[model samples]
Target chain A: MFMAGNVINIFKKELRTYFTTPIAYIVIAIFLVLTGWFFFSTFFLFGQTELRSFFTLLPIIFSFVIPAVTMRLFSEEFNIGSYEILVTLPVSLNEIVLGKFLAGTVFVAMMLVPTLSYAICVGFLGQLDWGPVVGGYLGALLLGAAFTAVGLFASSLTKNQIIAFIIGMIVCFTLTMVDKVLFFLPESMLGFFQFLGADYHFQNTAKGILDSRDIIYFLSATFIALYMASLRIQEKQ
Target chain B: MIEISDLTRYYGDLRALDHISLSIKRGEILGLLGPNGAGKTTLLRILTGYLAPTSGAVTAMGFSIDEKPLEIKKFIGYLPEEAPLYKDMLVYDYLNYVAAVRGITRERKTRRIRELTDICGLSEIMHRSIHELSKGYKQRVGLAHAMMSDPEILILDEPTSGLDPNQIVEIRDIIKVIGKEKTVILSTHILSEVEATCDRVVIINKGRIVADGSTAELKQSSELEYALNITLKGAEGQDVKTLLSPVEGIKEVRELGATNGELAFRLVCDTAKDIRDEVYGKIKQRDWILLEFTQEYKSLEKIFRELTKES
Candidate 1:
């Protein structure tokens, strides 16, 4: 219980840094612009009151933007040498990692908040499905958290923010594209590879199916990335 | 109390600390003195549980560093070299966050911060961003941060390395006052820093302890060795050296310089006996007029040089 409070303390501090710096605004603006352009440009073509197209493009957009949001988390601390001060404090490494992870997830949720206006606008134009809309938002959160964890792991690998951002993008991009590259794989590996693709599991939730397997996949991905990040930090220590 | 036994640490193949053993008493101001790259920082990091030792173990306040690092950290406040704080946060916010993490209850947090603010002289710049503050102010903020939990043990690595003289004095004063109650261990290569603030000094060289004692005790190790300078008028360099060289306890007498009718001779004496009177007696018996007579006490500076001097 006390450990949870320690995580919250770190979380608040990390979140404060996001709001104080220009990184949060720049990343949020780019996310809104890219998602708005991709979602609206085709909204009229389909002439549907559903947000299927917006949700489809979210995993790809987050692949780029979420890395940008999470890139500074550990890279900046290591670059500026504040990690020494942080680790010496009375908090454990697990608390610090979890706190930073939550901060990134919260920022992603804030970026998604403004897009709710699109759902309301589509509802007014025609009959809209609230079930998938809710599911898409939920899936976007889980996907954002998993990608944020990946970005955090990348940030832990180096002291350079640009390198962290690029590494995070590559890992997230690969996870997004893994299912699309199934033709090269043998038939027996198709099931395994498909299950590994983050997009496949994300789409399951985005379709309002809410399968236990999909939720488990994102949670475990986050856990594995965070665990690896902790191991890397321990190695550095 | 803190006890470290046979502590050794290595970075790859490079040994940073070698077979170190130390026991620090409660409420003692101990100074870890060494030249650069002598493993002072490495030892402090291990004690604070920031780094694991390659061998041996440390126990502080009944908590082992390996098993209860969090508990050890709970009562020890550390300020790393240069106090690499978050540059974007305000001083107040950073201190508040530290206080919360230290588990200071919310009700007592404000009062504790106010106390440190007064102690560290940070009342005026509490709201300023950390990066915008000057280096001295940043160090003071770091001091305030370290004292947030009112810890029983305080570890600071080169706390005055980059500060101005006035700031150094101010920080030393703060450390001295805190030393009255807390077990303060600070590391520095500066000899006078140990002289001014530390009750005990440990000199390390090349990853091993060369000397350890109180400031006066370290000076006393070489107390038998001292030098005396004699400046005389109407005297020749060779005559003055030959005359003073025969005095008992005088090891060597060398002519410093001769300008006009004045001559100076330095006598290197290696005995505890006061040979100044004997030298003066010899000078009075001569026709030479004595101009100056002074003895140079063995300072910690000289002892430090001798101990840490490379072979």
Candidate 2:
């Protein structure tokens, strides 16, 4: 119980840090503007009442945005030497990593909250399927959390924020685009490659499939990335 | 109480701390005196559970560092060199965050922060962001952060490294006050700081323990030699040297200089014997008017240099 409380303390501090600076507002504004423009540009062209394109565009957009959100989690601490003070406190490394990862995931959720109006707007135009809409939001959360973990892992690799952002972007972008490059692979490796793509599982839930395998893949990805980030942080000591 | 036994640490092939052992008593203000890169910070880091030693062990408050780091950390407060803090946070918010992490309950948290704010003299700038504060104020905030939990042991690395004279005095006063109740271990290259604040001094040089004792003990343990300076109005330099040279316990009597027909002589005396009375009795036999007479012992500064000087 005390362990969980320490995690909450770190989480609260990290979230407070995010809002105290203008980074949160600027990133949120840029994310909303970009997602809104791209989603509406093709909303009428597809002539579909469902918000399928918005879900389709999510993994691509998040490949850029999530990295921006999580880039400062460890990079800034390392750069400023606050990591020494932080680790020396009574809290364990697991608490620090989990807390920061949750903060990044929650920030992604907040960024997604504004885009909910896209779902409501399309619902007003015609009969919209609530099943896919709910599944899409849930899948968006899992994918956001997974990408946030990957971004945090990348951020842990260096003290330079820009380098962290770029590394995170590259990793997230590769996961999003991994399935798209399957044609270059041999026939036997096709299924294995597609299984590794983040978008494939996300698209399954976005279509309201609710497959346990898809959900497990996202959760395991988050766990693995966070585990790697914790390992990297431990190496620093 | 803390005990470190044969603790060794190396960065790649570079050894930062050789095998060093120390035992610190409760409520002792111990000073770690060393030149830069002498492993003072590395030793403190290992004691605070921040860095693992390459060999040996540290046990603090009955808990071994390797088996129970968090337990050891709970009882120790540490301020790293330069007091690196999150520059963007407000002083109040930063302290509050530390209090929470240290597991201070919400009811006691406010009262605790209020006490630290008063203790560190941070009342005026509590609401201001940390980046706006000067270096001294930032160090005070770091002090407040370290003391948030009111731990049994406080370790500070060069707590007054770059402060102005007044700020240095103020910080020394605060450390003195805190030293009364806690086991305080502070490291510095400044000799006067150790003389002013420390009860016991440990001089480290090149990762090895060179000297460890109370400041006075350290001065006494080194070769005991002191100089007595005397100035005379009517006596010639040669006459004074010859007269005082025969006195017991006076090793040498050399004329320092002559000005305005007044003469000065320096008497090197062995501390094993009291030569002041004999010299004064011998001077009473002369017609020379005594101008000035003073005794100077070997200072801690000189002893420190001698101990830490490169061979």
Candidate 3:
């Protein structure tokens, strides 16, 4: 069915579109500047060399950043009516969803790769923990993938990109806050509810623990969200 | 090549397409004529597999739309009403993207793109961004996008809409050329477009098809009447319309007279009744000299207006 070819075509087009606009560059530049400033400020102040603080700040930063990256995945096409053109093409819904998901995740990775110099700088100053650095990046990449899936689903719900971004933020924030917010739930239900939180698994991976359970959680979350997004597209057709 | 049976579509609670059925052979350029909200787009969306009918069946190239949308989509090309395009992409890149999605191999993609640029007259502005192009060129690019796969069926919704007269003619010429090798179904409210390009027409109003035939057949079969143009000699000073306005079956009389002692009058006659003989008798009785009397041809416009206005 040429499914792989369809995904590649869609990915190429999506990636090309990202580079064609100034927004991608602006987003990437802001990401590097902020991450660099925050990392160096903490490093110089504490007189220590570690990326732990930077890793801790990343989840909070990406709560807004990842949604911005993925907000237009489906929303812009729907707004401009180009989704009509896409659906009319011979490609299946799975191909479109997967292609767009990867495109957004790749853009986030492109932004993340430049920040590796921050790790190098830490290594130059003092003894650095390579384990946590690798683990933090893996966690960041996994979280970016999950956030992209959530953002893709939110974008499908509306043609307005701003609304899509807001929806993505709300959904992702809820997933992160689920573990922290135990006020309404009974004490007995806290552990089970904490397990459902997106941040709960990422904490272990961000600490370089490399837990299979955490990896499985991110993969399954991404799969489920993308599956939901595909369902929306199918119902539209 | 296509068969639609008892097709009905509902948009929420409102029925947008109501029990429509038709068959189309390969290589026929069919025109869909309808007013706004007449379900022309809806019907086309169904045919292209962009939409699903509420309760009916459509089979194109032996594949049902509901059962095998991707297979049928592989055979058909559809251009939506606005010709929605990525305005930022260069025209060449956009077409290439479409070609890639259509699974056109690299070797053939290059040759196919060259062929399309030539066919669509897009060579001059191939490197320009889509936003920089004029509306006419945008439509040409959209046409190329639809044709990139060399599809067997093309469903264009308002293919010639929102263009100047010259651009309309250009697009019409393109459609005429493409019609030779492909089965084209274009929808428009402009009867002249249908007259100029379509081999067959289906006029739909309120989601129901009212007329289906070739241009000449629809014009001839339509109950729309024609006008009788009269030129009178030696009756320049007289009010010819006043004299002939009272004739039966003549709904309205319009006069076009010159100061050189010649009068010309046109009469809108009822198709159900013959009024020419009565008008001649009245002219003779009134001693109004008649030089020429002729009936105009029944135009497609007349047929469309009459058919749409009737039910």
True contacts kept of each: 0.88, 0.88, 0.90
Between candidates 2 and 3, the DockQ winner: 2
For residues A61-95, write the lDDT of model 2, one tens digit per residue. 99999999999999999999899899899988888
- The DockQ-derived docking category for candidate 2 is high
Worst 10 residues of 1 chain B by lDDT: B216-225
The iRMS of model 1 comes to 0.7
- Give me the overall lDDT of model 1: 0.92
Second chain only: TM-score per model? Answer: 0.92, 0.96, 0.84
lDDT of 1 at A62: 90
> Which residue runs of candidate 2 sit more than 4 Å off their true CA positions?
B259-262
The DockQ leader among the candidates is 2
DockQ, every prediction: 0.85, 0.86, 0.79
**DockQ class, candidate 3:** medium
lDDT of each: 0.92, 0.92, 0.88
lDDT (C-alpha) at residue A4 in model 3: 87
Candidate 3: tens digits of C-alpha lDDT, residues B7-113? 99999999999999999999999999988888999999999888889999999999988889899999998999889898789998999899988888989999999
B220-304: candidate 2 lDDT, tens digit per residue: 8899678999999988777787888888888888788889988888899888887888888889899989999999889988987
Clashes by residue pair, model 3: none
Candidate 1 residue-wise lDDT, B111-202, digit = tens: 99999999889999999999999988888999898888989999999999889998899899999999999999999988889999999999
Ranking by lDDT: 2, 1, 3
DockQ of 2: 0.86
DockQ of structure 1: 0.85
